[model samples]
Target: MNKILLGGLAALALVAGIAPAAAQTVEFTVINNSSYDLHYFYTTPSNEDHWGDDLLGDSGVLEAGYQATATIGDGSDQCLYDFKFVMDNGAELIEPEIDICQLSSYTIND
Candidate 1:
């Protein structure tokens, strides 16, 4: 992840009013350990059916063995969120109730 993404996360956290010492310190690290390069990253409310904007925006690329980290919400207090990782080949992995608060990192295994 680049400094631009980190700066964006900081802004998001502040807008959401997440305390500095809380879960906001921990980032959601998306790992692409598969053979394919993941192109899009989405995180939305667990109950929502539609995937929200790409979390990666213009910096959306998690190559094999690499990880991209982003802080999505306020300490939020809510633990559930959906994650979608998509590849160029039209393959995708969607995970629900990711418990973003408790997870230090999330991995998409081979």
Candidate 2:
């Protein structure tokens, strides 16, 4: 397991907003184009105060050059969210204010 950067998640949590929703489950394909394996994935509603839980919890890591379909069923009406990606080397990457309802796929590249 990679060391999660609490500071990075904290920074992302500071930006908050409520967005209109179009669906109950925000489904999207995530492509890992980076060199490092993706150890963890997290999605938090933009209106929330903290990163709730790991979407990839206990399943497996998203290996490099591969993709996976992620379904977020947080039961929130907000569509906008902040995504946190933890690499195998303890690197943290964050994409803020992503409208999951409008996107079909998201890619993480080196």
Candidate 3:
């Protein structure tokens, strides 16, 4: 009886120690309405240790009035990330700020 109880307690402890593997997939649609060709960069917000290196680096030359779609990851975060778009001439086009959108709020559960 003692061995059985200990085994059950160990099993419970093992189960409790394991965290649930929550993942998220994000799809991004980028539109370039500016006259100049735009270059974009993506990075995880949590990546404070390495800024550009941690970025997904979805760089591209987007012509004016052109649109592109980018799909990224199975992340463990609660929401999706709104990738930061930077132009080749060192200008940012996103309004308000860089980390603006709340993509995680509308994330789809898998």
TM-score of 3: 0.48
Kindly list the per-residue Cα lDDT of model 3 for residues 50-95, writing each as its tens digit.
2322122333355556554434442434342334556656776432
**Tens digit of per-residue lDDT, candidate 2, span 1-110:** 22233333333333222223533666677889999998788888888868867766564577888877776766677888999999999999988999988989999998
Overall local distance difference test of candidate 1? 0.69
Alpha-carbon RMSD, each predicted model: 3.6, 8.8, 16.8
Which of the numbered candidates is closest to the native, going by highest lDDT? 2
Instruction: State the C-alpha lDDT per candidate.
Output: 0.69, 0.73, 0.41
Runs off by more than 4 Å, candidate 2: 1-23
lDDT, model 2: 0.73
Candidate 1 colliding pairs: none
The estimated TM-scores of all candidates read 0.72, 0.77, 0.48
Tens-digit lDDT track of model 1 for 17-53: 6455554434667777888877777877786677766
Number of the predicted model whose TM-score against the real structure is largest: 2
Residue-pair clashes, model 1: 0
Error of 2 at 44 (Å): 0.5
User: In model 3, which regions exceed 4 Å deviation?
Assistant: 1-21, 46-59, 80-82, 93-110
Clashes (backbone N, CA, C under 3 Å), per candidate, total: 0, 0, 2
